[model samples]
Each structure stands twice: as C-alpha cells, then as structure tokens.
Target: MAVVRSLRQYVEPVVFGAQMACSFFDTGLQMVVKQRSENATSPSDPHEDQNAIANFYMIFNMLTDFIPILPALILARIGDRGYRKVPIVVPLVGYSLSRALLLLVIWLEWRIEVMYVAPVIYGLCGGFSSYWAGVIALVSVSTSEEQRSLRIMRIELVYGIAGFLGSLASGHLFQLYTVGMKQGVLLASMSVALYVFCLLYATCVLQVSRITLERRESTSSGIITHNRQDRTIIALLFISGILYDVAVAGGVQILSVYVLNAPLEWSASEVGYGNAAGFLIFITSFLGMKFFTRFAVSDTSMIMIGMVSFMTGIYFMTFVTTTAMYFLARSVMLFALIPMPTIRSLLSKQVQGTSYGMTFICLQVSFTLASVATAPIYTKIYESTLDTYPGFVFTLSSIITFLSILPISVVGCRAAKQENYERIQGN
Candidate 1:
C-alpha cells in the first residue's frame, strides 16, 4: 500500500517526462525529415530546397497552433468544470497517436508533406494548449497564492530537466543502429511507448484535490475587479506575454533547420547538445527567479531583465557561424525563461482562484494567434534571405522581443506608481 501511494505521488512527474521525451523525439524527427525531404526533392539549388522545406515546416506548425485553439478552449472549460483529467488524458492520447504516425512515416518512407496530417489529428484531440492549461489549473489549485509562483516554476523545472535529458539522448537514439534500421525509427518507437505510459499513468493515478476544487467552486462567482489603471496594466502584461511567446516560438521552431543548413552543420549529437542548452534556459531561469526573489526584487523588474536577456541573446545568434558561438548565445539567454512564468504568476494573482483555467486558456489562445502570424512571417523572411542572410530570422526575433519590453515596462511603471500612492495614503 505504501509503495502504491509513493508511485501515485510520482504520476505528474512521469507524465511530464513522457511529454518531454515525445517533444525531443518530435524535434529530432522533424529535422531528419526536413533533411530527407530536401534530399529527395533535389531542387536546382540547395538553398532553395532548404528555404522551401523550412517554409513548409513552419506552415505546418502554424496550422497546428491555429487549429487547436477551439478544442483547447473547450477542453480547458471542461477541466475547469471538475473533469480535470479529461484535458490531460485526451491530449496524451493525441500526442501518442501523432508520434506513432511519424513512425509510420519513417517505415513507409512517406513524403514529409503527409506528416502535417498528424498535427491536425493531434490538434483535434486538444494538443499542447489544452494539456498545458489543464496542468496549470491543477497546479494552481494545489497551492496557496503565496506558493503559486514557486509551485509553477517547480513544475516547469521538472519539465526542463526532463527535456534536457531527453534531448541529450535523442540524437544518439536517432543515429543508433543506422546500419540495421531506419534512422530515428527506434527513437520514435521509444517516444510512442513513453506517451502511452503517460496516458495510462495519468488516467490511473492522477487525482484532483477535492478541497481545492471545493474552494474554487465557492469562490468562482466572487472575482474582484480592478480600477481602470490596474486593468490597463493587466492588459499590457497580457499583450507583452503574447508577443514574447510568439517571438520565442518562431525562433525555436526554426532553430533546428537553421543549424542544419548553415556553415556550422551540426550532427545529430550536436543537435541534441544544442537542444539541451536551450532546455537549460528553464533551469537557469528558475534559479534566477529564486535569486531575484531573495533580494525582494519586483516581478516587473524580473520580467524586464528576462526580456533584455532574450533580446541580447537572439541578437548574438544572428552572428553565430560556429557551434561554440551558438552555445554561448544560449548561455547568455539563461534569464530569458523568467518573463513568461512571472507574467503567468502575476496574472494568476489578479484573477479568482477558480478562473485559473480560463486565464490560462485566454493566454494560450493569444499565444496561438500570435504564433500563427509570427511563424509564416518569420518563415518568409528566412526563406527570402536564405542566400544573403539565413540568420535574419534571429534578428527579427530579437527586434520583436525588444518590442515586447515596452508593454512590460509600462506595466512596471504603473505598478510603481500604485505602490507609491498606497504608501502615501497609508501615511
């Protein structure tokens, strides 16, 4: 009985590990397919082929981001209604199916274009947006308001650690037994198995806290409203959060392809290493938050620091022609992870406990919409500049990240003014 209880306690971590493993596999597999597709098409020029394949990849991802919004919202609403596991379990099922489809694509040597269908299926089943919103809601309910940021960051830390480990091994897995079997087949198989385990574990072991649920129910109808100034601050935070996420997503989605084509052609192992470096952003960002909090730094200050770190790192990426430079650029952006979680934490504080699901849902919707626009635009810019400056996309990302800082700064100033006013009134 004790063993069983201990195992139950690990359900969330197990689910998170599975999800991260699948993501690593998907990332590596997509890179492999992109390269394979470019080789098979044999365009007149290598750069043109690269451009076309990257555009297709971005478009497919954009579709996935856009198509999942409605289903994700519906699933989040259902989760908020007390069926919390529905959103989590359904998305796992979708993820497993989509990963399986990639295995099929590998076995049959199908065209990469057919892979787009997998994401559509995954989106219809609720996708990452729904899965994440549910997880956030569950975590939010499990902790007090004072503990919320730390709790959420702890979850993200688990996610990052899992991603880092998975990424470190994924490249080796992809290249394993390359002589006896198809590349990435073994890795994809492992991904599918992990996701299947995730689905089963979540269904069988994860449970909602009845106390938290009851509290949420009692408090659902009593969310407090803010003054106009405060409302403006919240709105600016939301806008900045959306823009920051879009820039991050667009930059990351194309990073694999970017490294694969450039003067610094990285091998599968190198790709894994590069990805691990990116995952480290989560760990470092969490640590940075803790460090800042010890000094009682304001949330807005942390956010601004994160934005500047991201902008600086991305700008450096535009000049990266060597692997060392790439990793250095990533290292400089360790603080980049601060903004999103801080923004989410702030938003959570502003709303009623019961509304965490809806808040996350709205955030995901805005993120998706921004991604839909950003992906295609970045893809077009990257493709157009393939011959002259393939790294131009990074420059654009840096610029957009800089723009995100404006809204955040506005919110910060408003917050400072409010604090001063409150202190004066108290005197």
Candidate 2:
C-alpha cells in the first residue's frame, strides 16, 4: 500500500508512461532497429532497407509483447502472491538477458562483418524483451476500478504526448549529434548505450520495488470468474487494437515519408521531429476525458468513434502536401476515440483478478498481429502498380479500417443506450 501510494503520488501516469515513447529511430530507434535487423540479407539498396527493417522490427517487438500481455492480467489476478511474480518474473529475466546480448552486439558492431547478425540479434532481442504488458498489469493492481478506465486513457494519452515529445527531442538530438558529434556507425554506438540504459533501468526497478499485492487465499479466487461470458468489451478490444495499429502504421509511419518525399527530402531526424509534433495534439485525449468526459463515453465506443475520426483523418491526410497538414491529420488520429475511457472502465467491471492481465495481454497480441499484418494487408489489397497510386494504399487502409469498426460500433451503441436508459430510470 505504501509503495502503491508512493507511485501514484510521485509518478503521474503520463510522466512514467512517457519512457517508452521518449526515444525514436532518430535518437536511437533506427540504430536499435538496424542493429537488431543486421543479420538479414543485404538489400540491393541500403536506403530502401531502412524502412523495411524498421517495419520488420515491429514484427519482432510484437512477438515479444504477445507473451506478456495476457500474463499481465494473470499477474494482477494473482496480486502480490509470489506466483503472480513467477509468470512475469521468470520471463523478465529471459527477456533482459536477450536484450543485454543485443546491446552487446551493437556495441561490437558485429553487423559490419556478418551483416545478418543484426537481424538475428534484433529478432532475439525483440522476441525476448516484453516487460511492458506485465508492467501495465502490475500497475493495474495499484489502481481501483474507477481508475482502470482512466488508466487505459493514460496509456493512449501518454503515448501520444510522449511520442510527440520524443520526436521533438530526437530531432534536436540528431541535429546536434550529426552536426557536432558523429554520424552513421557512431550514431549506432550511441543507440547501443541507450538500450543498455533502458535494460539497466528495468532491472533496477524490478529489483528495488518493494510493492506486492495482497494475496487472496485460494487459486480459485484469482482465476477468471467471468465464465467466458461473451462481453462486448472483449470483442471491442480485439478489433480496436487491430485498427489502431493500421492507423498508426499507415497514418504515422507510411504517410510521414509520403508527405516528406512529396517535394523535399527530409532527413530521418527531421521526419522524426515532424511526427512528434503531430502526435503532441493527442494530449487532447487527456482533455477529452478530463473535461468532456462524454468524449470517451465507453471503451467499446472508443474503437468505433476513434475509427471514424481516424479514418477521416487519414483521408484528410492523403491530400495533405505540407508538414502542417500532416500534423493536422495526426491530431485527428490522436482524438478520434471518445469512447475509450468508458469502454476500459467497462472492462474493469467485467474482469477481476489475474484475468485483467490476460485480457490486456490479448489486446497486445491484437496490436501485434495488426502491426505485422500491415505490409501483407497492403500488398494483398493493391494492384502491382502500387507505385503509381500512392493514394491507393492509404485509401485501401481507410476502407478496411472503416469497415472493421461496424461490429464494435453496434455493440457499443447498444451498451451506451442501455446504460443511458438505466440512468433515466434511476432518476
């Protein structure tokens, strides 16, 4: 309780959560990705491989995240019991060991010799390091039911703000380093250091933390009591995660390059900075929930409502040629979902104990599949002459993303209406 109280008071969700979003390809993300992907066959051209490897890195990270997301629910279900820690703790060690090796590989610059070493290392490091979902699950133990919905909001909100700031920070860092410090391989060395820092910090936190959940008596108490009742919230999480990734990949990653390449060739760092500025507007999620609580009316509704805003935002983005227009498009991506808070809250109501960790983990899996599916989905949808129709890819994504929202929207609307009627009757 003391530790929980301390964390709640000292660590605002946004600040602590920002750690994941703070760095990017420019500051060190690219180097990390490259070092991670070094083992792959040399691309015919180095330039094209940059984007491709980065995309592939997402696949690796998704795999690592998949193992932990559900474990989060279980860990929370187990609470402070030593067993809760087992599922998460054992994996944490395995993950850390792999990450440490990745850092060592980068430090050695083994890619220069084997080339493919980076890719193999990337996969190994990526498939292993997955403390994020479990971290979320542990945090869940500290929060009350009322806070769970808001916690979901914080995850999205903080990522938006932190991602933006990191982009901005990376831009400045890149400019400073490239002009004054170092470039290319030297830059890769710096990223290796950063990874070490992240790994070290994670280890220290895990080691020092005295926090533990109060143990429930029996294993049955922690097991999911929901009886697999078909719930609207569960379905919505799965669907929303998929669409969210498509939106992120298409709107943020792919479109940034598209916009930048339109007239001027923005360097990687510049692109990173621009992306941060756009995501900063997602701070609106905080405002949406805090002031206009109606915006995030429900978790189930977030996917539906966010989808409409997101798809429209993407359509609006396709026509955008300027950096400012790109920002506008990304901002829409930030605030499209008003129903997320409500929906997450609904989830808290449904899931109890370690099950919360499992549910959240499942959502992570959804995001993973969605992120990995991007290239395949894009390739399958388009004609071979996709080069001629830059807009075709964006357009296809919009249509599919929009279509994906229908089922969730229906379930969410029904829930919202039922809740409204119940309120009226109480009055």
Candidate 3:
C-alpha cells in the first residue's frame, strides 16, 4: 500500500500510454500514406510514389513542428504560474482529438489531405512541446540536483519501453480488419482509445504540486548579478542541442519514407520492427548511463560519448543496403539516447526550479524552429537523390552530428575550469 501510494506521484503512466498510442498511430499513418500514394501513381515510377510520400511528410512535419510554438510558450508560462497540470492535460486533449481525426479519416475514406487540420487543432492545445516540457519541469523540481539526470533518464526509459512494445504490436494490429472496416481502422481506434486514457490519467490521477512562486521570485530577485560562466554554458548547451536535433530530426523524417521505397521495401510488420529497433536505444542508453555514473563519469563526457555513437551509426546508415546491415548500424548507436536528457538535466541545473517549464520549452521551441527550415530541405535533398543516392541526407546528418560536438567540447572545458576554481576558492 505504501509503495502504491508512493508511485501515485509519478507521470510515467501517462508517458507510457501516450507513447504507445503514438507508435500505433505512426505505423497506421505510414502504411495508409504508402497505399494511397501507390494507388495514385503508376508502379513503373516508384520514385514518384516515394516523392509523394516524402512531400506529404515534408508539410505534415513542418506543421507538427511549427504550429505549437506560441501555445506551448503560453502553456509553459501558465505552468510556471502554478497550474502544473494545465500544460500537460491540454496537450493530451489535443493528442486525443488529433488521433481521433485520423481514425475518422481511416473509417470514412476521407481524403488524406483532411488530416492537415489535425496538427492545427493539436498545436492550438499546446502539443508535444508543452506536454513534455511540463512533465520535465515537474520531475526537475521534485528531484535533487544530484539525482536529476538519472531521474530524467528514467522517464525517457519508460517512454522508450512503451514505444518499443507498441511498435512490436502495431504491425500486427494494422492488419486486423473486417469486411466493413478498413485495414487501419482497428489500429487507429486503438490509438484514439489509448490517448483518451492518457488524458484521463493526466487529468485525474497523475499527482504534482506547484513550485512556490514566492521562492522563485525571491531567488530571481536575490541573484543581482548572473554568473557569466553559467550564462555562457547555457548558451553553449542550446547551440549543441539545436544542432543535434536538426541532424536527428531531419535524418529520421526521411528515413521513415526511405524504408518504404525500393531495396528494403519494408512491409508493415518490418516497419514496425524497424521502429521498435530504434527505440531499443533508450533502454541501452539507460543501462549505459548507470554503468558510466557508477564510474563517476562527468555529464559532458557522457554526452560526448552519445554524440560519437550517433555520428558513427548515421554514417553507417549511408551504406545500408540489406536489412541486416540496417540493424547492425542501429546496434552501433546504443548510446545515442544519452545526449538530450542529459542536456536537459544540465539545463535544469542552470536555472531556478520555478523556471524549468519555460527554459525547457524554450529549448524545445528552438528545436521546432530549426526543424521548420531543415525538414523541407531534407525532403528536397531526398527527392533529388532518390534515384542516384537516396542516403545523402543520412550523410548530411552525420556531418551535422560531428559539428554539434564542438560546442559541447567548449562547454566541457568551461565547466571543468569553473569546478576547479570553486574547489580552490573553498580550500
């Protein structure tokens, strides 16, 4: 009973369920888009079908990344004002409604173009940017500074595990159909139902409390002079984060469409398995963190290790021709999940606890803004290289990943200097 009560304070349940729903929706939408595009284009021109799918995603992803910016900021402000759940609950509502729209499209045979409005309604309610930042803010304020990194990583681990399980089942679920129902109806309906569960869980069950505004204002007011080093570190962290995100997001956005094309030509089940393989990094990363932390590894060092892992893996991705080679490349990225959460943990340490929501949202919104330019550019690159060199975008991602490492190295040098100075001053 005590354990159950203790667990009641967590938001992991909502993360788990919502991620599961997202996995289902992702597979369903991908296969649906594939089918529709194939039906509209001649089989002789596979490149045209691939381009159509890529074009749909280029706009769809932009809307997903762009529309939520203002609402997310507003919701973050509200979260900082004391209503912690508002940021989370509102976005879950958007998630549920948007996923339900897909279900309608699947069941009624509406044109896929109708789905464009989904992100609009979703963005108005604050979207994933607000939702995740809210969750991180709550977790950051509740945990001690020393334990924050592990706590955040644990949350990410739960999110990944849920996605893995959902992806494993999604392919089989997508094939479930009756005479009157469409192929994806069951999967789409499951996504809607799970999102509704997440909404309810967030609304009524997930327990959180407001960080005291008086304390926050007092801390802010009391710090008359901001530390120059801390500000520099924050700026550096943001730069590293933005560059890494652009690489990962642009690469992933194209990879999804790439798998559905020739050479691999992955079926629904294969696609689900491939996504599930990607989520495995979360588990491996969590384990890697535990091992590294036990050895007293610095956060920046851990981040560098993760960055290198992704760099190598994405470079290898440029040469993937067989399914086995694809998995081998994925296996090389075992630590790729470490950088972002650890970066967030580092950012949380640099700010007052009360500003966690706003700071995290600023970082997320920055990622979204970068994606606005990079997503379309990646699609264009993919389209241009489809027949000759389809993996060019992956190679580009690897280059960006290497570039992201430079700012982080600067951060490591600055952080070490600050620590040594503080130690000498104390002595």
Candidate 4:
C-alpha cells in the first residue's frame, strides 16, 4: 500500500512531462513537413514560400489561441468546481487527435492546407491554454505556499528535460526509413503514441492533491476579497506577464521562419538541435531560481533579472548570421525562463486556495489575447523583411521585452510596501 501510494505521487508529473515531450516533438516535425511541402511546390523561390507558409502556420495558431478562450474558461470553471481531471484529460485527447490527423496527412500525401483543420479541432477540445492552466492550478493547490515556486519549478524541470530529449531525437526520427513509410510518418506516430499514453495515465492514475481539496473547502468563503493594494500589484503583474509572453511568443514564432531561410538554412537535424538549445533554457532557469532563492532573492527581482536576460539575448539575435551565433544567443537567454513561472508562483500566492483555477484562467486568457495581436504583426514583419532584414522581428521583440520591465518594477515596489506594512503590524 505504501509503495503504491508513493508511485501514485509521481504519476501527474510523469504524465505532464510526457505530454510536453510529445507536443514539442510534434511541433518540430510539423515545421519540417511544412517546410518540405513549401519547398516542393515553390522550388524556385523557397524563401518566399517559406514566408508564406510561416504566415499560414502562425495564422492557424492564432486562430486556435483565439477560438479556445470561451471553452477554456468553461473547462477551467469545471475543474475548479471539482472536476480537475476533465481539463487535463480532454486536452490530451484533443492533442492525440490532432497529431493523428498529421499522420493521415503524411501517409495520404494530403494537401498541406488540410493541416489547418487540426488546430480547430484542438481548440474545440480546450487547447493547450486550458490544459496548461489546469496543470498549474493543480501544482499550485497541491504545494504549500513557501515551497510553491520550487515545486512548480520541479514540474517545469521535468517538462524541459522531456522536451530536450524529445527534440534531440525528433529530427533523427523524421529521417527514419521503413518499407512503405513516408518521411516523418514515424515521428508523427511516435507523438500520437506518447499522447495516448499521457491521456491514459492522466485518466487512470492521476488524482487531485488531497491537500488542495482540503484547503479549498476550508478557504472557499474568504478567497475572493482582497484590499486595493494587492489588487493593484496583481493587475500590474498580469499586464507585465502578458506583455512578456507576447515578446516570447512572437520571437519564437519568427525564429522558426528565420532559421529556415536566408543565411542559415538549417536542416531537420539542426532545427532539432536548436530546439534542444531552447529547451535548455528551462533547465538553466530552474537552476538559477534555486541558486537565487538560496540567497533569498525576491520573486520580483528574479523576474526582473529574467526579463533583462531575455531582452539582451533577443537583441543579440537581431544580428545573428550563423548557426553558432544563434546558439550563442540562446545561451545568453538562459535565465529567460524564470519570469513566467515566477510570476505564476507569485500570482498563486496572492490569491486564496479556491481561486487557483480562476487565476490561471485569467493568465491563459491574457496569453490568448496577446497571441491574437502579436502573431499577425510578427508574421507581417517577417514577410515584409524577408528580402532586406528578416531578423528585424527579434529587434521588435527586444523592445517589447524592455517595455515589460516597467510593470514588474511597479509590482515589486508594491509588494515591498505590503511586506513592510505587515512587518510593522506584526510588532
């Protein structure tokens, strides 16, 4: 019984890691397929084709992000009302179905345009925004306040490690050969298999943290009311987090297009390696947080440090001409992963136990809204500058990231005032 209970404790994180790995692998493989299809059709002008395809891809992603807001809110409300697994399990099902559609596209040699349907299906099932919100809510409610950051980081570490391994192997998997098999079919199949496993584990093995349930019951009545100052700080923090996410999302979306064209025509293998480098950011940021917390750094300070690191790295990326330079830029952004998760931890701490799901829902909504605006803007910028300066998107990202710091500064000051006030009251 003891061993069984101990093993059960590991199931949620394992499932989360598996889901992340498969998602990243699927994303990388999808990019390769899109690139290949575009290349096959427009062999004379691969650069122009790449820009067009990238725009289509980002538009599809933006639609998925936009369409899911209502459904995500509904699912998150359900989860908060005691059906936590619904949000997680349903998204895994959607993910598996979407990946399976890609396999069909590969095997049947369907038009690349058919791929657009998959994101709509994914959105109907609540999409990644809902899934991640549910997972964060679970982590937030389960852990104690003091250890919440570390606990969330542990999940993030597993997610990063899984993505690292998946990305390292995904390119090689795309190159796999088998009798009567199309290129990338095997990789897509593997992604579907992993999603299936994740879905099953989440359905059968995962349980709500008992501590979370107890706290929710005990604190249900008092969770909604907060004084004006904390509310102001949280609002500023959310605004900052949303802007920062916009920079991150726009930068990553354009980076894919940038790497696939012009001076750096990376192969499938090289793309995987680049993605692995990106995944390493999570591991390094986790380590940075651990080290800084040991020295008693505040969450706001950690967030400021991370934003600075991201801005500097992105600024450097604007001038990257070679693969080595790209990787070097990624390395400089090692601490860039800190701000989002730390902001999440801080937000979770501000609210009462029963409000975790709602808080994360708002965060997801903010991200969705940011994506709606940023995706098309970045896509247009990349398309227009394809001839002259495709890397201009990174410069824009750095500017937006720099702007994100102002709200963080406001949040930090407000938090400090609250802390000092509590200290004085305690005396």
In candidate 1, which residue ranges exceed 4 Å CA deviation?
1-11, 178-180, 216-229, 421-427
Once superposed on the true structure, which residue ranges of model 2 sit more than 4 Å away at CA?
A: 1-5, 8-22, 25-129, 177-181, 184-212, 215-228, 250-253, 256-264, 294-303, 336-345, 379-386, 416-427
Which is superior by TM-score, 2 or 3?
3
Candidate 2 lDDT score relative to the true structure: 0.51
What would the TM-scores of all predictions be? Answer: 0.93, 0.70, 0.96, 0.95
Model 1 poorest 10 in a row by lDDT: 220-229
For model 3, how big is the CA root-mean-square deviation?
Answer: 2.0
Q: Which model scores highest in TM-score?
A: 3
Ranking by TM-score: 3, 4, 1, 2
Error of 4 at 289 (Å): 0.5
TM accuracy, model 4:
0.95
lDDT of 2 by residue, 1-427 (tens): 7786454422234233333323443345454444444446475654454445534544444454344444444443453343433334444344334434433544454442233333343333223222344455555555665566667567656666666766666655544444433434343444444444444444344431334344421222443353235566567655655665566555444553354333434565666766666666567756666654555455555546666776787777656656667666666665564444444445545665445556555555566556655744553333232345555666666776676677677766766776787699999
Residue 290, candidate 3: Cα error in Å is 0.7
lDDT tens readout by residue for model 4, 1-427: 8877666656455445565556455554556556555766667865657767686768777877897788888889898887777888888888889878888887887877777787888788888888888888887776766888887887787778778878888888888868899878888888888888888888888777677577754553354354423678788889999999999999998887778776887887887888888888889999999999999999999999999999999989999999999999999999998998888988887776667788898898899998998799899888888778878999999999999999999888888987798799999
Best by lDDT: 3
Count backbone overlaps in model 3.
Answer: 0
Candidate 4 lDDT score at position 242: 94
State each candidate's clash count.
Answer: 0, 32, 0, 0
Q: Across residues 175-213, which tens digit of lDDT does each residue of candidate 3 receive?
A: 999999889999999999999998998888777644433
